[model samples]
Target chain A: MQYAERILDAIDMETFILARDEGEAKGFMGRFLADLGFTDHDIVFLEQVGPGVRVRARAYIHRPGGSYGWLAEGDDNGG
Target chain B: MVAEKKKILLVPLDPVHDMGLKLIRKALDDKGHSTVLLPPGMEPYEVVERILDEVEIDFVLVSRTLGYRVGELLARFVDLVEVSGLRDRVTLVVGGMAVRPELAAEMGFDAGFGPGTTPGEVVAFIEDRPFAYGGRAEASEGGKRDLTHGFSYVYRKKEIQKRLAAIAGDIMGWAANKTSPGVERARLRFQALNKGEKYREEFLEEYLDYCDELVVLSYKRKQLPDQTRFLAQDELHFLKQYQNWEGRSKAARSGIRKPDVFIQYGTGCPLMDIMHIKVCEAWGADGLVHFDPSGGARTEGLLEGYLAHGEDGTLLTWENLRLIKNFLAPNTLWQVRAHRGLNTPETVVLAGELGADLTKINMAYASLGAGMDPARITIDGVEAIRWAAHYDLPFDVVTNEELSGVPAHKAFAGMLIIAHLALQLGGRPILQPLFCRSPEVMIYGQMRDNYIDYNAAKILALQQIIDAPLWPGAPIGFLTHTEDRVQSSLTTALHASLARSLGVEAISIASSDEAYAGGPIAAASRVDTLRATHEAFRFFGRAGIQPTPRAREWSKELIAGISKVLKDVANSGSFVQSLYRGLLGGPEDGAYPGRVGRDTLLRKEKGKDV
Candidate 1:
C-alpha cells in the first residue's frame, strides 16, 4: 500500500500563512498544496487574522464509491 | 522477572515546569532504580559537570519546556556532553511540553517525549522495552451502559398516567383483532429463520404474497432496486482489514458522568458506514444509531442481501445489518431504528435477532410525520414493541415530529403515549425529546431569549409527568448548525453539554456536516463534533449550565398542554382514531396523517389466519 493511501480518509493541513487577505490566503494554500503534490484538495476553512490568515486545507486520499488504493494490492509506497 | 537496577539522573533543564522530571523520578524510584534529581535553573554545563563527576549512569533524562532559545541551549548542552566524553557512556533523553522525538533526534539526543507522555513510558524506555502509545489496555475500561438502568417507568403525574392508561387500553383493544402485512411478515420471518429450511421455503412463499410487487420481484428474481447493488467480495474483505487495522482502542472521554453520547451513521454504503462508525468509536462516541433510507420506510418490504445504496441512508437488510454489527466494538451500543416505516415489526425482529442493543419505535411519528397510515402503524408499532420486549431490547420513543413543526407539547404527548404503550406491553422505552431549534420555536419565539431555558423546559416537563429515561436526540442542535464546520461542531458540542447538564441518559449528536448539504458527510466531519464534545465535557465538568426561572413556567405550560392532548385522545376512545383526527398533532400544527399504508389492516377472525 502507498503511504498516501494509508490515510483512511482525507488529510487536513492547518496552518497560518502570512497573507494580506482571504484571497491571498487561498492562493497560498492552493500553491502550497500543489507544491506538496496534492492534486485533489479543497479549502475547508479560512480566516484572516491580524498579520496572516488561518487556513484549513483538505486533500482527500479516498472518498466513498472510489476504489481505495489502500485496499488494492501493490508495492508499498512507504508513506 | 525483575531487572537489575541502574543509576539514573533526572535533570530539569527548564527554570520552571519541573513537574515532568519529578513525575519520572517518582516512577524511577518505584521501579527500584537509584535516581539523582537536579534542581531547576541549572546551567547545561553544570549538568554535564554533574553527569561527568557522578559514577556510571545508565540514563540521563532531561526535561525542558521549549521556548525561543531552548533549542540552541539543548544543542550547546549536547556539544558540551560530546566534548566531555560522556556522550556514548549514557543514553540521553529529553521530554517536555514542546519536545518531539524527531526534534530530539535531529539535535543528537537519544529520545524525546512530548506533552501527554506518561511516566510508565519513561520507565519502559529505561527497562529497554518497546513502549506503545495509548495502549489498548486503557481501551477496555469503557463498557456498554444501560440507558434504561435506574428508571422505574412510573408516571409521577397521576392525571397524565390515568389518561394515558385509558388511551393505552383503547389502543390495546383496537389492535386486538388487527394485523398488517408488516406484522405477518415479522411472524413468518421469525418462524422461517428459527424453524428449519422446509419452513423457510413455505414461509417465504407466504411472505411474498403479502409484499408489494417491487419487493416480490427483488426477492424472487434476485433483482435489486435502482442505485443499489450487492456488496463486492473485495469490499467486505477491505472492510474486515480496516476493522482489524484500527484494533480495539476506546475513544477518550471528557470525564463527566451523566449522558452517554451517540452518533448516527448511515452513509448509504455499509462499507462507508463502517468506516464512519470506526472513526466515531475511536473518538469516544458511546453509541450508534442506524439510519436507513427514507424510501425503505415507504416501501412495503425490505430488500435482501449485502447491498449498498448510492444515496443518503443505508439500506435496511439483514445481511447489511449483520455486516455492520460484526465490526462494531463490543462496548459500542448499536440501535437499529424501526420508528417510521411499513416494515417496523420486521425491522425490530431483524434488529433483535442480530443482537442490536436498542431500537426506535413511535406510532404517532410514523403515522403523522413519516407518512405511514395511522391504523397500519399502530398495529405494526404495537407488534414491534411486543417483539422488542420479547427480545429484551429497550427502544427509544423519539419525538422528532417537533422537527416537522409540531409544538414540543404535542410531540411530547405523542412520545409519552407510545412510551406508556410500550410500558403497558412490558417493553422498556426511553423518551427522546429533540434538543433542536424546531419550527415551533421559530414560530412561537420560545428560544428567543436563550437555547438553554427552552430545552431545559422540555426535560423538566417530561420529568414532571414520567420517570423514564430521557435521551434528547435524533440529533441535538437541529436547525441551528450552518455549513461552517466550526459553527456546526460548536453548536453540537454546546447542545451535548447542555444535555449532560440536564442529566439525561444519552444524547445523539450530529456530525460537523449537519448543515452541509452539498455532499455526503465526510469521515473527518464525524471526528470534528466528537472532538468538540470531548472538549466541551472537559470544559464544563460537573459545572452546570443554569437555565433561567422561565424554564419552570414553560414546564408547567407544557405539562398542561400534554394533559389536554392526552385527555382528548382518551375521550376519542381509539388511539388510531385520535391520530387520524389530529388530536395529538394536526395539519395546522404541521403534522399530517400519512397515507402510505392506508386501509392496509386486515381483521383476524376467530382462530383463522387473514
Candidate 2:
C-alpha cells in the first residue's frame, strides 16, 4: 500500500483524504500522520501477499475500544 | 568506533512561552541529537525522576519565558537533578527570555542561553565539534574542556556560551533585515505608536470622535443572495419536510429566522457555520455577515457540484437567491468579499451598480499581501467606497483579521477605530473581531486572552456607534459555533443567554449543517429544531435570569479593559499598526510555522556539520 493510505487509516474515517496526483501522496502522507490527534497507537507494519502483488501497510492500532480489524483485501491483479 | 546518537531531554517550564522549546527541538534534531519533548507543565521533581528512570540523556534544555520565575524554577530543577545523582551524567542548559546568562551560571546551570540563540551554535555544542562557538574562532578554545571527563558540567558550560553567542548573532541578523516586510511592519508599528505631537494634534481628535461614533452606530449590510447554493443546498428537502408537518406551509421553515442565514454550508462543515446562523436569527439578528476568505470554496462547491447527493440541486445557482429573497426581510444585503488580486473592486462595484445591496472589501492582511503600503490601505478603502458611491452601490468595508496572539485590548481598539473610519467615509463597516482570536480559541474552545472582554467591549462600542450615527457601519453579530469543544450546545445556550443580558440588538446562530459538511437538508433540519426551541423560549419569556457578583464583576472588568485598550491605540496612529505589533512574532503576520509562531521562533539555533 502507498504510504498515504496507511496514514489516512490511522485517523477516524470521517476525515476526508484529498490527493492531487500519485507523486504527491507520500510527502502528504507524512504530514497527515503528524497532524492526527494524540493517539497512543503503536506503529504496526503489516505485509500481505496476494496472487501477484505484495503490499505493505504501516498502521497505528490500539485495542482499547476493540476497534481492531485488518484492512487486508488481497488484489487479484497485483503490480 | 561510532559514537551513539546522544539522547536529549527538552523541558518547557510553566509560565514560560513554548516557542523556544520547538525551535531547539528542530535544531538539535538536525544536528543528530535524539531529542525527547517533555509535555508542558510537568513539575521539576517529576521531570528529574523521569530522566533518571528513562534512557541516559546527555543534556537537559529547560526553557523559561517569564522573567523572575526562571531563576526559581531553574534552581529547583537543578537541585533535583543533583540529588538524583544524574547531575554528573547529564549536561544542564537553561534558555529563555529575560534570562541573565551570567546569573544562570552562578545559580549552577553549566550554561545559559538567552534569546536569539542560533541553530548552528547549538549543533556545535551538542556534537563537541570544533567550530566557531560565538561569532569568533578565538573564543572556541577558551569555551571548551575535554568532552570525556566532567562531561555533564563541561558539555553544559560550552553549550551555554555558544547559545549566548547565537543570541548576539540573531539580534545582528534581525538588525540587518529590519527593512524586510516582516520587520518593516514591526518598525511601522513602533512608528504608529510614536506618532509625535504634530501628527497626534492633527489626527487624534478626529480619530477619537470617529471611535466615539463607531460606538453608537448600528451596522447593516446585505445578506448572501437568497437563492445562493449555500442556502438552497437542502431547500427542496426542507420544503418537503415542512410540507409533511401538520398545518405547516410548504414554505414554512423551522430553524432559520430567514432563508439567508439558514441555507448555505460553506465547505468546511455545516454544524458550526449553520448553527451560528440559527442562533443569530433566534436573537433577531439585524443582518448576516458571511466570512468565506476563500469565497466558500469546497463546502459550497459540494452543493453546486450535485454529485448524486441532492438531485434537485439546480436551484443553488440564481434560483436560490430568489428563494432567499422571498424568505428574508428587505434589510438584508448579501455582502460579498472583494479584494484587488482575487476580486476586482470594479466587479463588486458592478455588483452594487447592478443592485447589490452591500459589498464587503476586507483590507487588513490582504491589503499587505496585495503589496498595499500601510498608508495605501486607506487609499484602497477609499477607492472601494468611491466606486460603490459612484455606482450608487451601498456597501460595507470589513477587516477579517484572525488577530491570533494579539491581546484583546489591542484587537478591539483596532477593529473599532477601523470600522469608524469606514463609517466616516460613507461605507458601512462590518467588524468581525472574532476573526482575529487564537486558533485555540476558535478550534479548541480555549479562551484567548481578553476574548470575553473584547466581545463585551465590541458590543457596547458598536451600540454607541449605531446610536450616534457618527460612522456608517454598525455592529453585526457573527454566528460562531464550537462543536469540537465539550457541551457545545450548552455553551451556545449560555452564550445566547449572556448575549441577551449584554443587550445586543441582533445575533446569529449557524444552521446545524455548518462546520461539518455542506448545508445539506439534514443539517437544515437540525437548525430548524434549534430555531423552534429559541422561538419557543422567546414566545414564553426570558430564559431564567440571575447573575452572580463575580460574573458581573468579570463582565465589567472585561468591557473596561477593552475600552481602555481601544482608547490607548486610537490615541496612537494606526489601529492596524497597533494590531500588528500586538502579534509581532506571531503566525498571523506569517513570521513562523505552526500555531502562534512557536516553531519558527525556535529555529534560531544552528546545526553543526556531522
Candidate 3:
C-alpha cells in the first residue's frame, strides 16, 4: 500500500497511538523520523513488539511546542 | 417646512439584524436629522409605548430584518398604530432589511424603505418635499378625465408619465456618455416629433396605449421623415406575425391571464442565433428581478447605434431599429449600459423622449474614480424625464455588488446604493445578481471569464436587507454527460427550482459549452433540454418541496466565512491581492483547470507542446 494510505489505515482515533506495540515500532520509526528531517527530538519507546519481545518501539514524535501527538510506525509527520 | 432638525426614531427587532438599521440611523443623523435607535429584544408593545412616551418624533421608522414573519409583524405594528390613531397624524415610515416597498405598501405604511436608501431620501419623504425639478402634485386632468371607464386608464397613464419623467434626466446623462453622434441625432429628431402635437393624431390608428410616444414610420415609405422608424415587413406573413406578437404582449400587460409560455423566434438564421421574449413568466424564481439582461449582446446594435452616430462598426443601424420596432413586442424593457463610459446624459435625454423603458447601467462602473457622482447621473435622467413627462418613460437603473475592478463587499454596498439612488432620482431600480461562474469545471466552464459567486448564503443575507427585485442567475446546464442518469438537465432543474424557492425573479440555467465558447445554438438547445427537464420535475414525484436546506445553510456559513476573510484583507488595503493569493496558494496539482490560467488552456487546446 502507498505510505499515505498505510498511515491513514494505522490511525487509531480511540487510543491515539500508532502501532499495536511500541518497542519494535520505535527503531523503524526512528529511521523514518531521521529521513523526515527530525534531528532535535528526544525519541521514546512506549510499547513492545510481538507482546513478549522487549523491542523499543516508537510511539510519538515530539515537537518544540511540547504538545506532541502519536505518530504511526515508519510514517513521518512533516509539515 | 425646512425647519429645525427632524427627530427620527429607529426601532429594530431584538433578535434580528441591526446592521442595516444602524446604517440608516447614521445616514439620517449625518444628514441633519436627529435619530434614535432602539436595539432589538424589547417587546413591541413596550417599545412603542416607550417611544411614544419619550421622544418628540417627526417620523417613526421601524426596521425589521427578520424573515418569514415580516408581514404578520408589520400588520401587528400597523394595527397598533391604527388602534392608537397615530397613522395619519405621524408620518409612519418603516425601513428594514427584508422590507419591499410594494409589500410594505400593502401592509399600510405611508412609506417603506429598503436597503441602500440614501441619507437624504428619508428626509425628503418625511418633509413631504416635492422633487426640486419635477411636480409632486397628482397628475391634472386635461383631455382625458373619466373615472367612469372600467379601470384607471387615464390615471395609470398619468402615473406612468409621472414615474418616467422623474427618471428622464438620469437616462439622458447615461445615453450621452455612450451613444454615437449619428444615433444621438436620430434620437433627438425623434424626441422633437413627440414634442410636436401631431404625434397623437399619427398614432391614433394603431390603438396605441403605453406606446403613445414612439414616432412610428411605416416600412413602405422610402426615406421616412421621422428619426425613429417602425419598419414593417415587406412580406404580409411576417407582418401579420409581428402584429400578433405585439397584440399578445399588450394582452399580457392588460392584466389578462394567458398561456404560460410565448416564445418568439428571431429573424436571424435559426442555427446560429435566436431571440425570444418571456413575459412576467416564472422560472420557479423567487426574489429575483423581473427585469431582462439579454439586451447586452442581443441589442448591442441599438446601443452601438445610439453611441456611435450611424453604427459602431456593429451591423446595428436604422434598419435594425425599424425591424425591431415593427416586430418585437411593444414596450419591450430595452437595456442601456451606463458604466461602459460611452453613455452620456444627452443620449438618455433623447432616448427617454423617444420612449425607452428600463436602462440597465452599472453604478459601480460610474463610481470607479474614488468619488460619488449622483447629480451628474440624476440631472441627465431628470432632463429626459422632463421632455417625456407625458409618456411616463421610466429609467430602470440596474446595479451589482461585484463589478470588474472593485472589492466584492464594496461592490455589493455600491449595488444597494445604486437602487436607492434610482428611487431617489425618481426612477425604478432593478437589482441583478452578479453570479460567479467557474470556468475550470468544464461542466460549468465558459472561456475563463469569471463572474464571482460568494457563498450563496451571502445573497440570502443581503435579502435580509434590501428586498428590491432580486435576479439570481443560477447554474443550469453544467451537467451535460448524463444519459438520463444524474445529468446536467436534472441538476440544473433542481438548482433553478431551489433558486425560485430562494425568491429569485429570474433564474437562468447556463449551457455546458458556455464555458468553452460563446453560447451558440447548440448551447441554447441544451438550455432547452434543461427547461424540458424542469418542466418534467413539476410533473415528477418530488415536485414542489423546498430543496436541500442543509446545503443552503452550509452555503450561508461559507459566505459568512468568506466575508470575514474579505474584511480582514480589506483592512490591509489589498483585497484583490489577498483574493488572488488565497486562490493561487493552493497545491499546484490540486488547482481546478479553470483557475490554472487561460493562456495555459489556450496552449493546451491548440495541442502546442510546452
Candidate 4:
C-alpha cells in the first residue's frame, strides 16, 4: 500500500480477460480493478480478440493538481 | 591509446552457444589482447586447469547464459580457480543473458554483462577502461536543434511562388491597418511585461478592456472558469522541488537522428503536464508542445494563474506556462501553441517572453477548420506571426484542416499562404503537413492502397514547393490508430520511420492512447510509442523505406492540386474573402468559416471597431 504512494500519477495494468464480447470483457476488467480498490479508473484499451479480450486499464493513484502521494510530505516536513 | 597487451581467456559454458564469445574473442584479438577462448561444455575443473597451466593468465572471461543451476555452476568454477591458486593471479568474469554485475559478484565472479552488451564493451572491461553504455555520449551531447535552421525558403515551383507571393501581399495589405482584441491584448501584455512597474498596471487595465467579461472577472474578481482551479500551494511546492533533478534521460535517440521526435503534453493540469513532460523527456522526446484547452480558444482572453481544468487540454495561463517553461530540460525544445486560439497574439507574447523554443500559427486553418473568424484571425495571426519573429520563435504552419475533411491540396494551399506570409514577416515557419488518415484520405481513398505513397507525397510536394523544413505533424498516425497499444505504437513508429526516411527536421508522435476517447491519455501509452520508435530507428539504421512509384504520381498530383488552389485564391483577389468563400476549404469539405470574433476588428486609422 505504501508503494502505491510512490507512483508518479496513475498505475496501469495490462492484462487479458476471457469473455464473450468487448463489453463483457470491459465489464470484467472494471470489476477486477474495483475489487482491488481502484475507483478512479478507466479501461484505456480493450479489444475482443479470440475468445478473450486484451485489456489495458488504469487507476489514478494521484491526479495532477491534487495532493500527490509521490510527493508525500516527508523528512522535509510540510514546507 | 592502445590498451596494454595481456593474456585473456574466454570460456563459453554452454555446450552450443559460443557465438557471443567468438565475437568477443575476435574483438579482443583485434584489440591486441591475446584471448584463449575455451570451447563450450568445458568442465569447471578443466577450465581451472587450463587457467593454471596457461602462462600467467591475466584474465579468465566466461560466457554463460544464466539458466537453471547456472549460478551454482559458475560459483563452483570460481571455487576451483581459487583452490588451484590461480584465482589471485587470474581475473574471472561471467557474461550472458540475464547477467548483472551484482549477480556476477554474488556468484564469485569479477563482473558480468547482460544481454545487449557489445563486444567493444567487453574489450573495454578487459582493457580496464570505462565503457559508455546505451550511447550516453550521444544523449549527453544531443543538443537542441533549430527546426528551421539552414532553410533558404526558395520556391522551386516559380508559378506557385507567384501565386503565393500574391496571396501573401494581399494578406499583408489587409492586415496592415487592422487590429483585433487578440492583437490589442498582445500589445498591452507586451508593454505590461517590458515596461517598468509604473506602467504595468496601466497596461493591464487597457488589456482587460479587450478581453471577455469572464476573463476580466478572473483577473479582477479572482473568479476561475468552470472546472478550473488553481494548483494548491503544497502541490506547487512539490513541483518546485521536482524541478531540481537533471535531465539524465535521452533513451529516445537510440539511433538515427534526422527527425527529432516531439510529444504534446496537456493533462488538463500543469502538475500532470510536468510529470508527462519529464517522462517524455526521459524517454527521449526532443521537444514538448503545450496543448491548451479548446475552450481557451473560443474564449476571448487567457486567464492568469496556475489553472488546472478537468478537461482534455491544459488551460492557457501565464502562471501555468511559466511553471512549465522553468522545468523544461535545457536542450528540450518547448513549443507553446496558439495556432487556432482567440488569444493567438497574447499566446505568442507569453510563449516569447517565457523563452519557448517554438510556436504554431496558421490563419487559414484557424478560420476554416478550427472555427475562428477569418478576418479576426488574419489580423490576430499577422500580429502573432510578427511578434513570433520579434521573439525569434520559429512556428509551424499546420495543415490540420485536412483532418476536418479538407483535401490535402486545399489545406496545403492555406498552409503555404500563411507560411509565406510568416516568412515575409521575418518569422521562421516550418510547414507541418498532417501525416494522418484524414477524413479526406478516408473518403477519397488517397490512402486506401497504403499509408505510404500519400504521406510521402505530402513531403515530396512540400520539398518541391519550397526549400523549407517539414515537420510532419501535431502527431503522426492520428486516425490510423486502434485502442490496441501494440497497433497504435506500431503505426506511430512506422510513421516516424517514414518521416525519418524522408529526412524531416522534426515530428510529433501520439501516445498509444490516441484512439482511447474514453479518458485522458495515460503515461504508459506514451512510453509504448517512444519505445517502439526507438526500436524502429535502431531497426532501420541509415537505411530508408522505399515507397512505390505511386509516391511520385501522388507527389505530382498534390503539387498540381496545390497550384490550382493557389491560383484560385489569387484570382479571388482577397485571401480573407477566399477563406469566407471556402476557396481554401468549404462546407462541402466539412470546413466552415467560423464566426467567432466576427465584426470585431479594430481599425487603427479609423479609430473604431469594425
Q: Please, what are the lDDT tens digits per residue for candidate 3 over residues B1-610? A: 5546788777775476667667767776766778788877666676668556755766778777636776787778878877776666566667766454545677887777764354555666756663221100111112211111121112222322332233333344433333222223334445544567565354333312111122122222322222323233343233343244211111111111111111222322211111223211111111111111222222211222211111111123333333333433332333322332222333344344434443444433333321213332232223333333333433333322222333334344434434444554444544455443322222323313321123244446455444455544323333232434235455545544444445444444443333433222232333333344345434432333343354356445533443444344334343223223332111221221111111111111332322
* CAPRI quality level assigned to candidate 4 from its DockQ score: incorrect
Per-residue C-alpha lDDT of model 2 across residues B448-525, encoded as one tens digit per residue = 443344345444444433332111211212334443322333333344444444543223334333334443334323
Clashes of 3: 75
Better of 2 and 3 by DockQ: 2
Per-residue alpha-carbon lDDT of candidate 4 for residues B1-610, written as tens digits (9 for 90 to 100): 7778989888998878999999999998888889788888989888887876789789888888887898899999888888877777988888888776657888888877766678987888888887643433454476678888899999999999999999999998887788888888888888877886699679778878888989999989999888889889999997775586543243555565568889999999999888777767766688899998888899888888788989999988888999998888777889999889789999999999999999999999998878899999999899999999999999999998887889999999999999989888998999999999999888888888899989999999999989999999979988999999999999999999999999999999999999899999976677779879888888887889999998899999999999999999999999999999999999999889998889999887774886
> Which residue runs does candidate 1 get wrong by more than 4 Å?
A1-79, B1-10, B19-37, B41-45, B48-61, B65-94, B98-139, B196-199, B246-252, B606-610
Could you give me the TM-score of model 3 versus the true structure?
A: 0.36
| Candidate 3 CAPRI-style tier | incorrect
Candidate 4 chain B weakest lDDT stretch, 10 residues = B245-254
Query: For every model shown, what is its TM-score relative to the native structure?
Result: 0.83, 0.36, 0.36, 0.83
Computed on alpha carbons, the lDDT of every model, listed in order, comes to 0.85, 0.40, 0.38, 0.85
Worst 10 residues of 4 chain A by lDDT: A45-54
Question: List-wise, what DockQ does each model earn?
Answer: 0.03, 0.04, 0.01, 0.03
| TM-score of predicted chain A against the true chain A, for each candidate | 0.86, 0.25, 0.31, 0.86
Q: Backbone clashes in each candidate structure, one number apiece?
A: 1, 73, 75, 0
> Which regions of candidate 2 are displaced past 4 Å?
A1-79, B1-333, B337-341, B344-351, B354-362, B365-378, B387-403, B430-458, B461-490, B513-522, B525-529, B532-536, B543-610
